[model samples]
Target: MNQQLLSQVMASCVNAPDWLMKKRQLAVLLQERFKSTPAAEKIMAAWLANPSLAQLEQSVGEQTNADQVKAAGLHTTGWVNLPLFTAANAYPELLQENLMEKAISWQDSQLNAMHLALLNGGRFIYIPDGTIVKEPIELTVDCSLPNYHNLVIVGAGAQAAIVEHQTATGRQPAYFGTELLLGDGARVDYYQSNRFSAVQNHQAVRAYQAQHSVLNMYLALFDEHDLTTDFYANLDGQGGAAEIKMVTIASGQQVQDVQTQILNHGPHTVGNIVQNGVAKDKAVLNFHAVGKTERGAYGANSQQQSRILTLSDECKGEADPVLLIEENDVNAGHAASIGKVDADDLYYLESRGLSEHDAQVLLTRGFLLPVLNQFPDQKLREKLVDELAQRLEEKHE
Candidate 1:
């Protein structure tokens, strides 16, 4: 971490917990002052150079209303990453141990020391055994920093949905990670929507499932100057299944990379990933989906599907979906494709008396819009639609 930049960011820190500082100190020691990995080095450089947070602070005069945040059934933190409100009064109680650590740490350590020291506090949602929460829980994060350690736990036989929205102005940098665990027979649906402009964003998701549980995730990344997301899951429970679906729209020098991996350790476990991306202007996008079924995990099933629709000749997109099966009894497969909007379709729509712009927009929508079905909530679906429209309206190549 850059010392001067760290001081500037820390200036906004509010009512931070005591344990937070203690963990941060330890993280500082483990901070690997010289990042050995190229990726870590690049991330650190971005954090140091980002000016989004300071610029946002100068533009927005007032903090968002706490009541509105809570009323919307959101567990949210302010720009400084301090817990500002929790909807349904699901506060400290629901935010169990930093399962970002594990089931019973009772304290924070250096494992995530760097982020602990950099972030305010994380969102924690723990679902009890056999408890079915029909209404989806929404979490709103109004952060400008680079670390958000969020966790979700679904007890045995329980079912729940979690929707997370990250909104910020400017193309600065936003980096965060989420962790989820599902006990035996549990079912969960996780969805995320990011609304950022011209940013260098890095996002990560880690999940573990117990026997006979099911986990479904839907994510929408509107656009950014540079964006990367990594998804990791482990099917540790027999008969457990995981599905990840994602949609992205990028334009104007944007770069996007989304990768996923599933470690199959339980017999009869299933994992699948599906993603659709739209590239305009000179943007670039890449997708890597990997499924590895360890030996003895018999009867495993894995699949992947990915496609990219490039709007301009200058844009680039690639998809690499791979599966490594160590068990002969398992079923695994993948499909990927990249193409441009059909000129014949556009011409036919134009000959029907529609404007050229309208024809292209309609075609683009037809190609990339169906992914919205992944969202379970109508309101969320509408919200994402609006955001997508704004991004698509930007200048195309």
Candidate 2:
């Protein structure tokens, strides 16, 4: 939060582009403007007040090596990938076209501004126009020192898939921001797995879609920490479509606030949001899902479903679904609920000779089945299912 430390961090980036520097400066101004604003969520107040600004400052002058980055699971093949800061400094042309112009908004929140100003590590992935990538781009994050901010761009008519994993680490504060921009007719299937060891983690993902473009985002969160996530999709061009689905498991006294927003701003656009979460062992989970159809968006459609199941008496959960319809020609509706597991289903499973714990695990999986079915990769679905079962059993034991 000190000016001297911020200056040192900015100076550490060697030969960074002037435009990028201007962005950093704008972020600082935004941070100042929102300093007095309270976090929207009460649970995140303390964490947002001191969200690892010092950690980002400490990362100044540190150099990343091929070996270290590989150890962190950052090096990948079969796609155009580069270190985030390195890409900004060395290859500005790749990002100059549409970096923050549409993907991210610095004026959104103080935390967002701080993220851009203190960003020190991440990856940039680019998919050229008309290219069809047969395999999903795989990425992992293990090093938490570098406040990571990733950017991904998909050119017109391109189709690609991306999967990112966050491995366990220390009990440190961590921040990650990823913005995806899709050109006209582009299609992207993006998935994220959050299982990091940070005591407090802040994450955000935003997508900007052009005409006739499509974006599907899937999030599997199992972080046993205080976690706040912001996921958004903007259908900015005619005929654009976007769907966001999230499945989260909160256990061991964890607190999670997950917000997903979709805006239908173009004619004939479509947007959908589905979120499911399970809370056990005194954990708390809150889901906020919003679907909005802007004015002049004739024939736009928006729908959302948010549900949460609390498995323990001490555990708490909330599902808040909001719908905003500005155009009379639009169609929008939402469903939200926070409830306990169904007893009849559990009884039926137990009658089939399954133990109570086994039956509960199966029921949990079934609750998340809707979102699971939306994943494009079958292998990933199986993997996540197994991981979920194992984690549930471990927590119960």
Candidate 3:
């Protein structure tokens, strides 16, 4: 960790609440204690070599144009959007939620602390009780500024969809963290898409679902550099449910590590994870899916499926699916695979008047279609499909 920058950010927290300041201090202390853990090792190295706070401040000072925001499939309407810094000030009651408290883990404490201490720009969104949002809420995230955090809350019986688009056009180390709280009976469809070419992205999204609540998460990652993503959902109340679907492409020399986990802490809860990835050239892609049922989570159901397709001999991939069930009444299962495209399928397509490159692209899309079809937004689904096709075409051309 950069002690000089850390000291500067901590010193600048004069305006933060006493509790928040104390939390930041504890986060720093935890960082020092767990810096040597496996999960913290690679993340800390990435941060220590990343750009300084001064560069991020300058980048955040710049404005984002409408064209860039529109390209991410988002608009500036229909959502209650507030700057993350003063969100609690506008709604003083929100301070009672204690955001990020449940999302913290001993494994990633260092990176979590870094985000808490150095967060620069982000948004806060709240959905009230009994409200049903017809249109999806859209937000554009500029990744050039680095550490950006988002806090979203959905009240009891409320239902909504949120789309977050991250855009990075240049070389930078980017961190995007989200903490979502869903009240009882609330349903949320959260979608995130990444358009990064030169940025090394470190992203995390943690959600807590209350009784009878449902959470559906979709992730689309098409990056040309290293990327690390951690998505976790906690079913904290009886009958809560969560499903996570992810599609990604890692080409060139990129390295991508994605982890998805669902923790069943309530009776009759359901959790599922699905992921698909295509790796080409010298890229390396890894997906880890974990489903854990707590001791008293009776009648819980946990399932996961992960698949990876390698398009080159030089490329490497791993699909790891794990299930840990502590309750006898709970059900758990997992499936994982890492393999190359089929030569026979390619030959058949070529015989049907398609080029080899086109055949490979078609097959890859077909492999990912199951998860893609689950996206609730048709326009966002089309956008992801187009992006996937474009990247595949670029690789084959």
Candidate 4:
């Protein structure tokens, strides 16, 4: 690591505690393990020259207060009330060990300017081996600046399960990036929901899974915004499994681009992806899912599916599912569909004395329930369902 870069990172973290400063120093020292890839260098440089803590504190203070934000019926909890501090304190050991083991890497070539900023921004999380945390962990990323970047890293070990919820609430144009690593025999369950009002930008996430590990992710995007999300997972150990499910609702000139990839590198690995999207009022959504199996990954099984429901003549949706198989013994397939709701299904529901609007809402809720059903926390699941209902009402109105 360059002395100039070290000095820059040190200066940027002036307000951070001594322990965090030490962690940063350790991260810099560990960066040498990865080949000096361009992406890695860019991430390191940006982190070094990142803004000072005082500046971030002031920015947080100057943001629109919780009581001032207005988005449909969505209410804002105070910054302190959000789970930022708890998330920061929860996973230090997990991330530190991954950083030490060279199991994590960064790529700037795939990053946009906002991504670069997000990489330099936000808090960090880590989870160690045999940690069985049942409570869902939640965090809110509020961007007060016109353009900002935030990055979160999670590491899970053997027999570990974790749930994370991230929400973004603010008016500023923003970029967000997240990278997660699951160690051998680890089990992780994760969920994220994003709602943006009067914003234009993208959000990206990438994760890597090791041997005998399992990962499940649920995502939801509602309201008017332009978003591009990229997700990549590498199954590096035999018997590893990855499941990704997403639901997106868009209205009023919103556009969303989704790209996902699952790579099978170990024998007998398994991967599955399921997604549902709805576009209305001139909204457009593009979704893609890809599964790739290496030659050595014999007996690997991968399946991907994407379904979209269009509610307006002016709305458009595209679904793409791709499979790349290098081993003849592997099992891999993809399914995709983009269309309007079934008129016959609606007619049948209407015959049961349900109003058209009520029927539509009921059907939409049913379409999303499969993903929500995977949540282990009953309280969180109910809260999310209520939020979804509120957003759906806004769309109808």
Global lDDT scores for all candidate models: 0.68, 0.77, 0.76, 0.62
What tens-digit string does per-residue lDDT give for candidate 3 at 1-397?
4466557666756655566666655665666655364544655666667633432221222335433322222224333556665554445457435456656442366677776765665777777787788888786856566667778888899889989887765455667788788999999999998666544667889998899999999998876668888899999999999999998988888888898999999999999998989888888899989999999999999999999999878999998888888899988899899989888888899999998778878888888877888897899999888877787777621
Candidate 2 TM-score over all chains jointly: 0.86
Candidate 4 C-alpha lDDT tens digits along 4-101: 55566577556444555665555555455545534334433543455322222213233243332212112122111212222223333433344212
Choose 1 or 4, whichever is better by lDDT.
1
lDDT of 1 by residue, 231-343 (tens): 87889989999998888887788888888887888999999888888887788888888989999899999988999998778999998888888889999998999998788
How should the candidates be ordered by TM-score, best one leading?
Answer: 3, 2, 1, 4
The TM-score values for the models, in the order shown, are 0.78, 0.86, 0.87, 0.71
Candidate 4 global CA lDDT score: 0.62
Q: Give candidate 1's error at residue 83 in angstroms.
A: 4.1
- Lowest lDDT sum, 10 consecutive residues, model 3, at 54-63
- Give candidate 4's TM-score: 0.71
Write the residue-wise lDDT of candidate 2 on 185-286 in tens digits. 999999888666667777888999999999999888866677888899999999999999889888888888888999999999999898889988788899
Task: After superposing candidate 2 on the true structure, give the runs of residues whose Cα lies further than 4 Å from its correct spot.
Answer: 35-79, 168-170, 344-356
Better of 2 and 4 by lDDT: 2
